[model samples]
Target: MTEHRPVNITGLALKIPPALIFILWIAMMATLRYIFPGLNYELFLTPYVVGLFFILGIFLVLAGFFSFRKAKTTINPRKPEKTTAIVTSGIFRLSRNPMYLGFLMWVIAWAFMQANLVTFVFLPLFVFYMNRYQIIPEEKILLSQFGDIYYRYLNKVGRWL
Candidate 1:
């Protein structure tokens, strides 16, 4: 008889929820804005740009939420294994992780509102943290759960637009 070892799909990292991460990033940006007043720059259409991105972000988030609700799947990022269905309809068609993308847009909107170029540096860090700690682990569990169907969906949709 051959002995088999089960694979550890869950990641070994700080499994902070995506919403908390978003809040932390926003707070960090706010702190930076206060700490370095010289870094601020005035933009002509800051309000319009910020409003547009904020609204778009909210829309993406709601669409993603509704899609998941409609699918009767779990939206909790910390437990991808709990996801009952692979959502591939509506906003999911455009982005594999529309909710995360929405959060990213909110960050962008905050950056614009702050009008601080230095704050933009946090954007890539946000992406890196999300990909490393959150998305990758979830992807592993999802791949194990949905197999080729998930892979096909991944190949079809962009992770973020």
Candidate 2:
């Protein structure tokens, strides 16, 4: 029998938790808002728009969480290798990363509530950071774990929709 070694697919050395990253981005957005007070400009029915997005974000997150629970797979973002099964049903079918997408929506809602154009800059930054440090690493581990099945799923689904 040959010995097998687990591959270190996550190239990132600094593994910041996704929640912490979210908080940090929120802080950065707030700081930007404070720095550029003149940038604040509200839209008509801004509160209602913010509320709609917030509720939608919350719904997506809950849907993703419940789907993972029903699949009996690990939802912990940091431990993709521990994911026992590939979740392809429910919200997972719509977007491969519904939880992250939900979080992105929440950030967008917050930015809208802030009514500052400068705060909007953090949205793309959040996506870039998640893609580089979180999503890519997780995908590498999933591909290593589930192989062709995961590849097929990846092809079938959008990363964020």
Candidate 3:
């Protein structure tokens, strides 16, 4: 079941910033932890897990950001059409959506930090929403802008490895 939403309510396919959506997911996870305090578990390696994921998360985000900067492409998710180049080096070589993957890692860190099973449900939801509303639209714009070069890169990398 999807929302009774109009297709492209404006010329823009994206309405919300991905960062804001990430924040919303984090907020929802926190709310779930508060409302369902009993849904938590004991993880002896919680600190290690959280730290590793947090570090990897930040690393991937920065790597993606820097790669975009070096490639002279638009890093702004709101303007995929403005992307001047298709970056497939560094972190981009691993995942097409490295920044989003980093965000997912941060979400994982938050879930483990809470030690709450309920909050973990947002993981798949986050992926689903991002693929449906964010990545697909961005891919369309990239494909239109960069054509087969973008298509080849899409085939070469996993969306969220």
Best by TM-score: 2
- TM-score winner between 1 and 2, please give it: 2
Predicted candidate 3 versus true structure: per-residue lDDT over 1-161, tens digit per residue: 21222223244256788899999999999999989998889989999999999999999899999999999888889877677788998988899999999999999999899899999999999999888888888887777667778889999999998
RMSD versus native structure for model 3 = 5.8
Q: For candidate 1, give the lDDT.
A: 0.87
Task: Tell me the tens digit of each residue's lDDT in model 2 across 1-161.
Answer: 11222657545622887878888898889899999999999699889988988998999889999999999888889877788888998998899999998899889998998899999989999999999889988887788778888889989998887
Q: Residues 59-140, candidate 1, lDDT per residue (tens digit)? A: 9999999999999999988778788899888999899899999999999999999898889999999999888888877776
Candidate 2 lowest-lDDT run of ten:
1-10
Candidate 1 backbone collisions, by pair:
none
Q: Please list the C-alpha lDDT of all candidates, in the order they appear.
A: 0.87, 0.86, 0.86
- How far does residue 60 in candidate 1 sit from its true spot (Å)? 0.4
Stronger candidate by lDDT (1 vs 2): 1
Count of clashes, each model: 0, 0, 0
